[model samples]
Target: MTTAPGPAYRSAPTTFGAVARHGRAWLPVIGLTALASSAVSLALPSVLGHSVDAIVAGSGYGRWFTIAAVLIGVGVLCSLIDAFAGTACVAGTTAWLRHGLVSQVVRGGAEGSREFDSGDLVSRVSGNASDAAQAGPAAVTTVAATAPPIGSLVLLALIDPWLAVAFFGGVILVVGVLFVFARRTAEISLSYQQTQGRISALLTEAVTGLRTIASAGTTTREERRILGFLPELHRHGLETWKVLARSGAQAAIVGPLVLVAVLAVGGLQLVDGRITPGELFAASQYAVLGAGLGSLTGVIGEIARARAGIQRAAEVFAIDKVAHGLLPLPPGPGRLTFDGVTVVADDAVLLENIHLELPGGATIAVVGPSGAGKSVLASLAARLRDPSIGQVLLDGVPLPALNHHALRTAVGCAFERPTLVGTTVGDAISHDAIGPVRTLAAARATHAHDFVRRLPDGYFTPLPKAPMSGGERQRLGLARAWPASRLLVLDDATSSLDTATELQISKTLTEDRYRRTRLIVTHRTATAARADLVVWLDGGRVRGVGSHQDLWQDASYREVFG
Candidate 1:
């Protein structure tokens, strides 16, 4: 029975959960570095305020200047440590995440899925994963570094509540405004990423079909179609920047207003003789610290955009419905039997209730009209697609129960339109797999060796600069499929060959030289005439099965032949 296609990726834990699990080992070192840096930074401003108080009191500069210098040195040391730790964390996490995503894709068979678009998958794996990997560690570290400043704000609150209240209120307002803008930026960023994937897919398609474009004289039109999507991408980029600029301006305005309010309130208390100038200096320092923290809202905006990217990337790893089943096969010569099998594609049944059996080492020819599903039935027997209903048996075992690799090895097929994976003649002949000896022999059996041996490098000659003739490629395709062991399927394989060459290949296949179970899908009556049995198919069902002369004398068969 037919089964639906599988998902591109498995359902894994969330990206954050994965990061947290992997990054937990480094947390102690990162936390310690952040704490040291914040302590040193906070001490610098307090030391500066103390020095200013000493100067106003006319105290000697000797001790205070030395204290300030020591505090600066400590701040520099902590800054170095912070830099080292941040770089280490980012590098390590990026490497881990990239490797993880690649492994996930490989395990999921993402490349093999019909739902997986190659260019889109490439964009997700390379561009989106890189962005997310780089941002994840830095974002986490920034939040860690912000913790000490938050604690310092609380201490400043105890020192002077009015200044603290004004600073904290302003910070809350700035954060709220930035968050709203950040959400908008994130949405636009996601749209931009999706557009980038589409642009990549279009460019890939254009390159792949360059020959068709040139032959049709439509290169300019294709180029225009490719560039059409660029404007929308550009517009999204500008909108993201506009949100960032507006948020920056709001933060810039709020910083000064909070500082002014703190100064006015603290200055009045100092004038009233209720507080010392040193305390006022310290209060102003706290206001500056709060403003500095408020500015981090912009960094938060960047993190927000990155988080949206990560979420989109996570989708590839969230697909868990893919089908995977292992089938076993018994050892013997390959024989195929289709029992009440039907094949469906694109909402239409292409083959219906086909019951046929072929014994080992037998030759059977399948013939029908252009859309009579002969090729579709052959594909089912070869296991390229499963039957929609009923069973397809290889040997005594069902197709689904046979080991997929062994079944394919025992039952090889040469398609009506074969695809070559390499550039050279020899490479195409052996599918770039067999040794030189086997490759040449197969080419000779299919009569492709003569044309190939005359070329500049003999069998090593590369394919033509332009598209080669259909017949030349088809001969190479037959040569590639000639080395199979048990069952050989030719689906209009000789359609592009000349009459003489087709007759020679047909003689070689039908003769007792090769003991193989052969299934030939063709329209040529001459080819069918040579077969031991002919199966006639019409409108998705088999109408007659007999020898060629027997079918020729039948009236319905006569109408089809006519």
Candidate 2:
């Protein structure tokens, strides 16, 4: 399911300085290359002015012309280096941010990360992350960009103090225009990104439920609703260009005034013989370099976008990660206990005051009507989510107190809709802590070995090339979970299978020699009947806990299966 961004979406603030700091070793490369580019730019004007003087004097001018050409070549080479370094820096930082975001989301787990929509998280990771990586390179390059203008001012002053004074006036106005642009673009870009994320979320939700929409004949309504934010996105996009255009207009008016002022002042100095023709030409070149602030509008805009990206990424970073203790689990059968466990979301209690204990090495079926918190109890049994009010313990050790490896190695879970992620069908079952040793046995146990062997390459077949029905995928999920030695939780994991396959799999679960605790959340009366004990739940409270036959004697308990 997808959700719209609410007021608490961006609760944490991300700073530009913080983002730039992430560049680490890459920052120095970008800075050095950009400074080299600036140095070459500053040297070129002087070399060209000297070449003009040598030509006018009718002396040998080849040396000066060659020097000017070399300077230009050096400038181009430095620019190329700067570009390459900037690209590498952005690439590295994007990977870093993506890794951090993904790790954070995974650490939070499904229940903890429920506040975010899948599409929105995708947009942030792929799109906003790239934009955020620009912070380091953009900051370094923008700073280096200042060198040329400042160098021009110094050169203009040496040519004639009046030219420096004239260029400085335009610099002031250029700075003002840039300041306004940076501030305005930051606000508008953030809004644009938010709207874009919203559209992505709605589109993802629609795609996920595409079949429902088609069957209900509501595709038109869905399309309209998904695109509802387009107008707002369009308006924000237009404003970004409007801001750029307005700044360019201001620069156009102010830029020429500075160049004209320098030339006008330098011409008088030349007429008075206070400065040479070459010096006046040099002054004009300096004026052009110093007043070319309009050219940097694009760079400034990128910096603004980077800021917005950092802010958006901070939202994910702010999510509280599931923390585990350093202690390991001790040897015992998976004796599970729920002490006054409760789970509440948005003031609605899903599970309330669940205080019960299930002995080790028992196959227990958690049976209840829909919304009776059956799945919730199963999740608690596996410690996938911590109880809001009380702690869940395994073998008398609090689940949260155990370290990550200790807990994960002990429990395995299979879900109704399992996503098999690996390069090959065999690889997915062998993925995670399950390992390859049990892959074959687990497959055979779940009755998936035959269909898997029929594939073109058998276990070696790639996941994309190996097509599977819903039940087949579920069996693979069970195979993946089979390596657990302490507890196994099947949350409607076999629901897609036919009754015969389901019955066969159920027998394997009960009669297996491993003797580990098995918690099965199922709606089928057959599954409950096969369990050593049935945890009959109604309205989130335990109605009874005993043999299935004993609970079946109650008419209300029979209606739960109905």
Candidate 3:
């Protein structure tokens, strides 16, 4: 049997590779601008050394002021270029990552609940995407910061080779310490991000089930459960800080020692007349600029955090999307057939060897025990999921062979509790409507129009602001599904509606002008009795398929309702 995909982030490249792949067009621009800024910055120290020599040599004040003006102008231009480059890189990468993440989530092979909770998924999609977007800019900034130290070292070598070698050794030691610290930070940061996601998931679950918890008098218990993850999150935070502190202490000690050593060497060279006074001054300044800034360590820390975030974001995209073919479904009547269908996971079979044929424009009622797989069959019929071991065909063409647009246009589904996602009732139903009149007709068919008309602004009322009961929401969901012209799958969608409303809606569905291929999952015997055919399921196997009256003669079938 087909299995779920592997770990979400497995076999993915590193954050740097991902940024290079998606932000290739923008990265070159960022790099060029950053290099320009570095050039301006590198000029500063050399210009200062030249100015010092000019003063000692009694050079005219006019040339000194002219050099100062050039320095100021270059600084301003560097700042503007860096700012614009950073903004553009961030904007471009953010959009690219967000689009990729959302597409993966929407097209995931299984429902999101099977892999990640809503809150965890939300954090990975939004927060992780933002962090991943920073990778390109952070890399550019790190490159720019690197220039001053390397340029300073090159200048020091020209003054005295011995001094440059000694300072380079110390810088290497500091870099080694930073490397160790960065690795530790990445581990701790990943843990911290996961813990925060768990906490968010807990809080979301608690809020969504607040009524159940409150009614059961378990408020304190639920609160305690939500707070339990805080200590673990705090521990991870403290570990990260400790690593940073150790690295900072090592750099702090190394920086001053390297500076002192360079000063001493330069002083000796000056006494020996091996280097001039201005050269000694420049050499001392370069030593401090090269080692004292510790810019590399700071930038490395940022890069480590971004790597952790990008890894999390990559996990989302690594989930395998549901595979479908490119063929367009042919226009035909709504005839569905399941040949040798089977669904199994982890040695447990949820459906097995199911074969059934559904006629065009006929209503079928599926009745089964709680675990008999009624909902699973409905999902297969509409290609909400592809079967593991069989072909589900629509009008003699396999459902998976049909393009996505054709599949959606040919089939619609309404659930017991629909997630309404629009600002107004009209907007929600209009998403699936052929036109305005069809939209209104759908609402009326499901008896949702009467209550919608009573809302504060009729169909224009904001859904979030409008109060709705369970039955009303079901009606609205039905209205949204009502526009399907070829097929409709209602999986317990009417369980909340009263008898009178449910009967009227059923009548409308059965009318010749409004009828389609209707697959209804229900436990109500009366509902099944009204269908053209009934498929009775027992323990993942189809026990019988016939008219409801024919099946009513069996005592085992009658026990399904109880």
Candidate 4:
């Protein structure tokens, strides 16, 4: 089931704004530290100029000594503050962004509209989030960098208007260069990020499919395909370097010219007795300050790259989370109902006019031919996905109306090929179980306890070291899902098991304590025949609903299993 996405839930789009919103607790530290650092930086040159005047005057040594002490003290303080603030901001922002990205992806579910490959999603969570984390420090550093230029301009004007004029002219040219650099770098950086994501996707695909590739004797072909993305990545990277080089060269050229201009003008003023020797020294220092500040073009470049990364991360946040209603379901039997439900994807109608009203504690087998919507219907029943056009209800309450905990606890699912997540077999089976006894009981019911106990450490053995076949893995998945409160969905979950084991498992499910609404999707005639009722689906529509014997009377139905 799919629909146009709802409103996006996210912080601000701009990197700085996002950091500010997410890491507000650290903002005070960042702002205060940057201000102190910039103030100390601006004071150093003026104090040095004063010390030079004192030296030439043969004034008391105490003045120079105090200046040196002050300089050391402020420099130490500034460095400490900068270190603390930058580190805190980066760590905080990274945690915040990763939490938001992971939450969005997980809540969206397997059948939801927001989908990304494992590699691309990993890139966003790790690489892109790391890049976005720099927003906090970049903003602070830009503030610190601006202080020197503004202070120099004011001091230069005070010393001689002509000196200030010459410095400002060069600054204008540098600013222009940086503006162009930022724009060009932004484009290249986005392309670079996208290409990197593509390469990661290709590599991840190749690794996951390594066995298939090796068996098919196409390892070299897969390798070539993965490598093909490198040239595009290299080209984008080169474009970024070109922009940086042009900006660096222009800044370097302008820096020296500005220094010379300031020195020449100050020397003439000194010769004319328009300014003292100390004043001329101060003018030279101001020129260096102005040029040094222009180095913040480097920061601007970082901001551009950070913006590109943050933009990619923002795309992850923009994916709408699954919509849930406020109403909660009352505890009772899982009477499943689908009212005029429809499922569509990419403009193709997969299921149409699905209407079902099944009683609680019944084993309802959903049997269908290939291309039928059996799996889709099972997904709707478990609320793994919602219907596009109508509602799926549990005990007359819409699935979305139940809170996540209520819904998840009430309806559990097992898939044919399950990807379990845990180091030990015990952890994998009881990852979300209510008690260890319940976990053990579920495992025994699914016929996994015998094999699990045969392993070296019983259930404590690590899953990776304890080898198992496909059928064993499927049994474990079924055991893990055996604790559902009201409903259990098995979407061809036992397809790998032998007929005897599958029948035993099915018999266990129908026992007294295990009685619940069961929606089993299967192709086997025996499995369907055992169900209390069978829902026969064909070509995305419900063809019949009755006992397995009644449905078997139709030749087309018998042909499904044949």
> What is the full ranking by lDDT, best candidate first?
2, 4, 3, 1
Residue-level lDDT of model 2, residues 145-210, one tens digit each, is 899899999888887788889889889999899899889999999999889899999999999899
The runs of at least 3 residues in candidate 4 whose Cα sits more than 4 Å from the true structure, single-residue gaps closed, are 1-16, 326-328
RMSD of each: 4.6, 4.3, 2.9, 2.5
lDDT tens digits, residue span 1-562, model 4: 3333222234334445765456566666767767776676666666777777777888964676687688779778867876887788788888888887788778767753246677888888888788788776787678667777888888889888988988888777777877788789878888888888888878888888888999999988998899998889888988888888888898888888888988888888889988877777878878877887557767787777678788888777666567666667786678998888888887888889888999898999999888899998988898777777888889988888777788888888999888877889988789674678988998998999979999999888998888988889999999888888899999999999988898898788766375799999998888898899899999899999999999888999899899
Indicate which candidate wins on lDDT: 2
> In candidate 2, which residue pairs clash?
none
Off by over 4 Å in 3: 1-15, 24-26, 60-65, 109-113
For model 1, how does the per-residue alpha-carbon lDDT over 115-223 read when each residue is reduced to its tens digit? 5556776787777765565464456556665764576577567667776777777777666776777678778878888888888888888887898999999988998
- Give Cα-based local distance difference scores for all models: 0.73, 0.87, 0.79, 0.81
Stretches of candidate 2 off by over 4 Å are 1-14, 60-63, 433-437
Query: Candidate 3 on 198-255: residue-level lDDT in tens?
Result: 9888888998899899999999999899899999999999998898888889888888
Q: Which ten-residue region of model 3 has the weakest summed lDDT?
A: 1-10
- Top model by TM-score, which number? 4
Report the error of model 4 at residue 279, Å.
1.4
